[model samples]
Target: MILVTGGAGYIGTHVVRSLIRHGMDVVVYDRRPLPQPLLDGKPFLPVPFVVADLADRQALDETFEKYEFEAVIHLAGDIVVSESVAEPEKYYLNNVGGGMSLLAAMRRYGVMKIVFSSTAALFGLPERVPILEDDPVRPINPYGRTKWMFEQMLDDYDRAYGLKFVSLRYFNASGADSSGLIGEAHDPETHLIPLVLEVPLQKRPYVSIFGTDYDTPDGTAIRDYIHVSDLAEAHVLAVKYLRDASESRCYNLGNGRGHSVREVIATAEEVVGASIRTVETPRRPGDAERLIAGNERIINELSWKPNYNDLNVIVESAWRWHKGQN
Candidate 1:
């Protein structure tokens, strides 16, 4: 069985569902309540779950004792960039501390496989166009720094404790499951695509563009958005790789293309069939100019291919899911 931490969250929900569909008996370990799908809703798939924080060592011990986990997919962490800046301690506690607690449990139980949820924010201001897996990781924000620190801890654990791990550095995970049954429903959403999507949802009047003087073609930061389902698939593949491989690895998950803020809005407008209003402002602190991914490593090694690469298709999937919400 695979134990998915934060399996009730936005990305976790998708990843958990995908894992179960792949014929893997899964146990969801999340602090939040189990989502509707795992809780007797439409298209329900009964799953064993525990509602407890990763920081709770007693909870972690009991969970490990109960479930015969072959591997673990750790997705429990704070992800908001702005919030990470405002409260660095909170990010450290959950992202770093929580990760350490989970690792300790894994070490104690002799469970050695882990697939970490890292981020492209590990690059501060990119010295290269499409960042590579072996680039100099200089995280600017607390969130990125925490992820980087966790990756380093994973490396240390590999040598000291013999833990096999795969750290996936995701670049702008967008879109939703095509079924629309599970989608991005983050409380206090901060992702650009979803925030812009709010305009069409009638939840907000206009979207906020944080930076306009960026060096990109549209003077806005460009990001490569990999579909969430694609990312979830990569985690499964990574788990396979870690299980058979002898060395720890890291890979970037993305569309291998760039889309600026204006481009996202334009594509979203085209998808929604309505012009979304935008209000430009100064760039948020720790914001990078352009962070696109060079995904050849994962593609070549894991045979990972993103099925949803087009911006319109990505936005359209999100549109369909959000439109269903209201």
Candidate 2:
């Protein structure tokens, strides 16, 4: 059985569904309760779930004792970049410290494989567009630093203890499950697509464009957005790759295409058939002009290609899910 941490969250839930679809026995270890109305209906209700923080060593040990996890999909971590900056201690403790506890439990249980949900933030300010796995990692914020630190730990553990790992550095994970049963739902939503769609949903009056003076073609920041299901597929492939191979690997997951903020808003407008009001605001500090992923590594190595590569398709899927919620 595979253990998925943070399996109740946005990306985690999608990955859980994907794993179940692949006929894998899955168990979720998350602090949050399982979301009601499981996405694909009653089938998801039978999956085992353990509610506990990763920092709780006893909980981790008990969970390991209860389930024979062949591999772990680690996604439980502090994700808010701005919050990480404000409360570095929270990020370090839960992200880095909690990971250490998890590793310790894995060592005791003899579970040797993991699929980590890494981020492109590790690249920081990239030297060029289409970031590669070999790019110099100089994370500027606490969130990115914590992820990079865990990755370094993974490298050491792999060399010393034979703990195999696959780190999938995701770009921008957008969209919802095609089934439309579950999707991105955050308290203070920060993702671009969801925040933009909120305007049309009447949740907000207007979406704020952080900056319009960027050097991109549209004079707005550009980012690569990958559908959540595609990311889930990559995680499954990574798990299989590690099970067969001895060496650890890291790959960037994206569409290999960058879309500006203006372009995304325009696409959302087209998808929802409503003009999204926008207000230009000054660029936030450390905001990169463009951040796109170089996905050739995953494509070539794992034969994984994104099915929802189109921005309109991504926006439409997100719209459908968000509209259903309202």
Candidate 3:
């Protein structure tokens, strides 16, 4: 059986669905309450869901004791870049220390394989356009720093014991599951596509165009946005690869295309059938001007191909999911 941490959250929920689709027996563990939508009237295909904080050593031990988890896909942690800057302690404690706690528990239980949900934020200000796994990691925010620290810890663990891992450094995950059953649902959504879509629904007055003087063609910051479904597929592949391979590895997951702030807003407006108003603002700290992933490694190694790489396609899936809430 496989265990998923943070399975109630956006990406984790999608991963759980993918795993279930593949006929895999899975258990979800999260700190927050199991989202009602995930368990709504689904008694026949009952996927075991548990709410337990990873940092709590007793809870972690109990989780291992209850389930025979052969593999783990960790997706738990604080993920806001701006918040990480303001509150570094929370990121370090939750991302780093909490990850260590999970690792310790997994070690104790002899669960050797893991597919870590790492972020591209570890590549703070890239020296090149498309970043690779071998690129220098100099994270400017605590969130990225914490993830990098965990990657280092994993390396150490692999050397000490025989722990196989695949750290998939995701770049700007957006959009929703094609089934529309689950989507991005952060309480105070900080993602670009979701925030832009909210403007049409009056959830937010206007989207902020942060830093409109970058060196890009649109003079605004550019980011690679990959669909959540594609990311879920990558996680499944990582799990399969880890089981076959014997060593730890890392891969960058992205669309290989960058969309500027103006372009994204324009696409959202086009997809939602409305004009999106925006407010010009200064650059947010710790945000890079252009961040796109060099997805060649995963594509070449794991044959990972993103199904929805277009901005309009990504925004449309998000729009549908958001509108479904009403």
For model 1, the superposed segments whose C-alpha errors exceed 4 Å read 38-42
Across residues 75-99, which tens digit of lDDT does each residue of candidate 3 receive? 9989987788889999899999999
Model 3 alpha-carbon drift over 4 Å, by segment: 38-45
lDDT of 3: 0.87
TM-score of each: 0.96, 0.98, 0.96
lDDT of 2 by residue, 135-175 (tens): 89999999999999999999999999999999999999999
TM-score of 3: 0.96
Number of clashes in every candidate structure? 0, 0, 0
* Candidates in descending lDDT order: 2, 1, 3
Residue-wise lDDT of candidate 1 within 122-228, one digit each (tens)? Answer: 98888997899888888888999999999999999999888989999999988988887678877788888989999988899999898999878899888898899
Instruction: Report every candidate's CA lDDT.
Output: 0.89, 0.91, 0.87
| TM-score of candidate 2 to 2 decimals | 0.98
- If ranked by TM-score, best first, what sequence of candidates would result? 2, 1, 3
